[model samples]
Target: MKRSAMVLLGLVVVALGLAAKQLPGVDGGPAAPIAGPQVAVGAPNRGSESVGVELGPLVIEGRGTRTTSVVGDGGTVVLAAGYGVRTSGAAPALRLSLERRVGSGKWESTSAPVRQDEHGLHVSTPPWSASGAAPATTIAYRIASASFIDAAGVAPAVRSRSVSVVYENQAAYTGLAAQIYRDAAPYCPTTAVRIADLMGDVAGDYQPGTSLIRIDAVVGTGAMARPEIVRSVALHECSHERQWLNYDGTNEGRKRMLAAAAAQFSSYDPMGVGATGPSGPLKSDIRPIEHAADCGAMALEPRGYLGYGGSCSPTQLEAARRLLTGGRY
Candidate 1:
């Protein structure tokens, strides 16, 4: 079975039509700009670094980096680096060093061994403790690297551009969620749901494997500005998480569900923009999952669920209603 694409539905107003009004930032209003460098809490720092020299035939082709922060379960800050180097013979021994700073404090360093694959060399620092840090603490990081002893003994080194991320404690996220949905305040503490605020183009996504809910920085701030939209998107994504958790009541069932879900959305144009094709019809498989999600969101935020505004056919509507009322997927 094909693996499922990440279950992320970009919050698009055009797709929803009249339901568009229910979401903020879609009404031709000025989008809430991401304040700061616009990096996700644990995504790699952006920009590239060049290795000026070469080790035998090996040359750094490209650099891919990501950093992200995780809240709850003893909070952590992670830094990862991926180096694309071209070499056919013996690969070089790559070493990675990561430095971190919290607030005005001095920098602390950690080093780890690098692992190489067909694509490139990859390495990540151990999860740095974020347990006692203040909410919204800006954590700055620098990943430095050195490669030595290829086919011939030679040392080449490079440094990545500096990157920074803010750590939001669980309490801080709970407070933010509570501000949007009063019910969510207790839900966070009771269920121990982890929320990771991401920056850039991401809206919001939930990873069932990790039980991690990622809320785009833009979406989170927009929700704060328009509290009503929060419940709709939040509950919608949360419902997806529920489907992932249950996923037909067995491991194999969950895998099939993932493959189906991934296959369903892959047919759409990126970001659900425009039409699926020149014919201008949305993919048929998308209706049921989306309808189910919308119904779930509506069940929680009834005032906002407006029946997809004729987007669904009578048959699809009937199925969605059954799922909504009877909890049958």
Candidate 2:
């Protein structure tokens, strides 16, 4: 076959949605706290906690949460607190800090942002990710309020309540993941990105209800082992998230989406989903949703390799353009 013909065949291969070969692939607290904000750890990794601080005559109380184990990069820890007068009738100087222990390592200190107000205050810590740090990763957060900081910014600090959670493959990859997610802003800005080893041929996937797009690590020809794998899979999964964003509102729309999603889940095995490579099952099988996702990924940037294929079929591209360019699929 000629080069052009082979290219067409490749698109056909991707239409099967078994597109090309394998792919690639948080903290603490703070102070005399007065009614801190309430933040659950969140679904799929949610945890709950309620802590109280004694301010003498007035009790400073709040609730915080943490997940036991985090799977990927870009996960975050939220710490919040509010300001009030201590027993000494002085304004409490609060500092929120996070202590991170990586793979049975020493606790590293990290400063966190504090949301404050009379009613209540809460703020999320900087995004945390694991890369080389593993085996046993934990983040413990503490809320502390200095007895008082005079003009010199010195005072006796008394730490209050805290919570901790473990993480996997934390750090280094965070910057890369952030770049991928930032580039994906055109497709889905609100969606999250995670980096971890998916433990199979699977390089990437989108999880429902969590608004998370996962890009696997270099596991058995997965995420980072290959060039363009992370970008390809990340954007590809983001496409799925972009598609679902439209369906999240209505019951009928959700049914349409779920039905399509179910087909995607049942059709391809992780070990055998290569559009042009050996994993493709057939040329006739049409994986429209996956193709749409591929097309959607391409819409983000034309340069990166797509997991399904480097390029998309005209039909799939057109469909994706319709959805991403403001039309419903």
Could you give the C-alpha RMSD of every candidate to the true structure, in order shown?
14.0, 13.4
Output the worst ten-in-a-row residue range by lDDT, candidate 1. 55-64
Stretches of candidate 1 exceeding 4 Å from the true structure: 1-89, 111-115, 121-133, 147-156, 173-176, 180-232, 237-259, 262-329
TM-score of each: 0.43, 0.40
Per-residue alpha-carbon lDDT of candidate 2 for residues 105-182, written as tens digits (9 for 90 to 100) = 665566665555554444444555544435334566455544544432344554545455444442333565665666
Model 1 quality (TM-score) = 0.43
lDDT of model 1 at position 310: 22
| lDDT of candidates 1 onward, in order | 0.40, 0.46
Clashing pairs in 1: 41-69, 42-67, 42-68, 42-69, 43-66, 43-67, 43-68, 44-66, 44-67
lDDT of 1 by residue, 240-318 (tens): 4444434432233445554543443323333221222343235553443444555455555655533233232333334
> Which candidate has the highest TM-score of all?
1
